[model samples]
Target: MMEKHVQEFAFMKCLPALTLAAAMATVGTMIPVASQADTSPHSGPAQATASTQYPVPTFEGEWAIMAMDPVKVAGNRALGPAARLLVTLPDSLQKIVGQNHFSLSRQSGSAWQGKQDDLTVTFKLVSENSAELHISGKENHKLDLPLYRNN
Candidate 1:
């Protein structure tokens, strides 16, 4: 029949467009599901419990400068020999690094955080005997140190 033939021809002409519309609809539905999966706790920018997950090292000892010697100077001359950090644990959390003293607040993972006056000091442990310390002063200064444990 001619009518049947015309209907078949119209369907053939619209076949590609129908297939594309179906594909677009499927993708649109999947987009929301995919976004939800990204926001889930199992993946993507989740809160780090790195402190609990990793073993935190102690911050009770002396740390000596391994690099950036001249930059740590407080006055006209370098505080040679005396140019080291002495951290007394627990109670006072007293720190004697250069002419500044910081009170320890938290020691988590490979990091140590403290306060000196209004400034914050952070120490990122490099190894069991080495760490990188950043002291917030007039200008934030960093020191890469190799610690020599005294007991």
Candidate 2:
């Protein structure tokens, strides 16, 4: 009787191992062949497609000036100040803004340029939401202002 009981216990233990092995085999065979297809050749265009997720900036509404620092001239004179700008991205435009549409070019490093009528402004980022704005080339002459996002 003891021998029969020992055999039954061994069989029960083996049942769990058999079940586990069968489960693994089932899962291994279930893998979709399409998922394992060579994706490397298609990866470059896929990455390029992902980059297009961001949209470009356009002239639509009000964007604020964040910061402004003078860009030193060759002879210690101040040709202009660096500036940064921010625009409260409208719900309609948020998707495009994610691609860095509000960003502009400046005469110096990391500085952005803005224009209003006859005025052209230069700016640099002090933070993600703030910038230093330098306004010139108009009757306003020169102005430094802090621009902030609405939300």
Candidate 3:
């Protein structure tokens, strides 16, 4: 019938729009988001354990990592579970690392080490104004870098 043909034509006209709507819905779902809740014990952000308590409080201040050097500076300052380090990495090194926070601990004297996931950063105090930071990854060997401190 003519009425049936008209209905079919209307559906055909709306076919592209319906297809586009379906595609848009799928696109929204395609973007993956990182879950805040993690099931693994060590997979989430740093937790305040008795052992992870920072022993250097004297070095507590707004510390910024500038340059690429291994510097050692730690005193007795407790880094709580919510502590996070703002890191600015080189272009080549940014791909492997995610938005993970590094937890630092004093080794001995002026030596310190920070860890985030499988990455380890060693700090050696070069001077009161300057320091050194070396980054090492699980898959990669030793990668040393220098760091300068501001206040």
Candidate 4:
């Protein structure tokens, strides 16, 4: 009975320390949530997921293929025959690329391949700002185009 009393006394002595430790832990967890709330515009269910990160790098803006008028386009000849190709990834579709773009070809590593209606679209990222786009249209028309980010 005497030993039991001593043990209870020890626990009583440590109670305040244990309560402080639990409070500190709760505050530590809340700090990150508070900071994340301030930094991120979308929280809770709207937060971005792993799938949102899969869109081709530098492929989120407006891009136009080379034009015949070299002076207007600043003579970006790497465009080659793809001069007629125009690619646009509006902000709306960029967020759900997997459900939209990946439906056709699915995402190959570092690239996206898919078919929309009669056009077969393949996008390969060469760099952050440059990518190779291949489109095969109906009637055997094929365009192997290099794309550059415009915006």
Candidate 5:
């Protein structure tokens, strides 16, 4: 019984300190990290980095992967050459590429290229409506997909 009383006394004395520490932690989280980070101007080239702009291709936009079986589209012989080419792409090229996003840094008429994360992304406009999306990633993994202009 006496040990219990001593234990309670110790806890009572520590409670205020624990509450203060918890309150400090709460206040720390309430403050935005951006407001706390040092924003003062540095003495060197780091400031110039803010102005370095990445070139954006004029055709930078999302494209979709076209799932086509040449045998299915075979019946539609009347399809235009460009449309036909998109549909008849070899199975060797068919791929399930996630996120049909394109941000080509460089462009030349129908061709475009850009680096997205670790993947090299490229596209070729087949028509005003259709495009080809190609992404090459680490270990030479490549993806070829058909796309339709989303906008």
Candidate 6:
């Protein structure tokens, strides 16, 4: 009777294993395999395109100096000066006038003068988004400050 009881317990365990294997086989056969050639329309390479050009601003006006700073000149003990210029462009570039204001100073023994005035201010528009101002009037010498379009 003990041998019969042991055999019955072993059979019960085997039955569960058989059922699990059958269930996995059924699931595997029901699922479909995918192919590699399925291409999506939005997955293609982006086309090459040209960027739009921005309009340039006209440089013609009476500008005042806003601020100035000293910059190190390459290989020179003296520092280069930078100024913030306010300018109003004229209808013609030939009749342009501007002002430059700088906050730059040179070393005690350095041969540099920081200055900003009417004679030192010069303005030029490089592009619609940028402009260049040259200042050379006071203790500070030449400066080139890039200006962006306010709009």
Q: TM-score of model 6 relative to the true fold?
A: 0.25
Candidate order by TM-score, highest to lowest?
3, 4, 1, 5, 2, 6
Considering summed lDDT, which 10 consecutive residues are worst modelled in model 3?
A: 68-77
Top-TM-score structure, candidate number: 3
Candidate that would win on lDDT: 3
Candidate 6 lDDT for residue 134:
59
**For model 1, how does the per-residue alpha-carbon lDDT over 1-151 read when each residue is reduced to its tens digit?**
9999999999999999999999999999887753444655666333323353223333444555434221121111223332223343222122334444443434555555666664567655554544566655546554434443333
TM-score of each: 0.36, 0.28, 0.39, 0.37, 0.34, 0.25
How many backbone collisions does model 6 have? 24
In angstroms, what RMSD does candidate 1 have relative to the true structure? 14.7
* Winner of 1 and 4 under lDDT: 4
Instruction: Residues 1-151, candidate 3: write the lDDT tens digits.
Output: 9999999999999999999999999987998877777767767333333234333443333334454222233333334443333344544445545433345665644556777777887655554434456778776866665555545
**Could you tally the backbone clashes for each prediction?**
0, 15, 24, 2, 0, 24
- Measured with C-alpha atoms, the lDDT of residue 102 in candidate 3 is 48
Poorly placed runs, candidate 5 (over 4 Å)? 1-102
Local distance difference test, per candidate?
0.48, 0.44, 0.55, 0.51, 0.51, 0.41
Per-residue alpha-carbon lDDT of model 4 for 1-151, expressed as tens digits? 9999999999999999999999999988887653343445553233223244334323445444575211011112233232222234433433423222323233543455667677676766565556676667688877676666565
* Candidate 1: C-alpha lDDT: 0.48
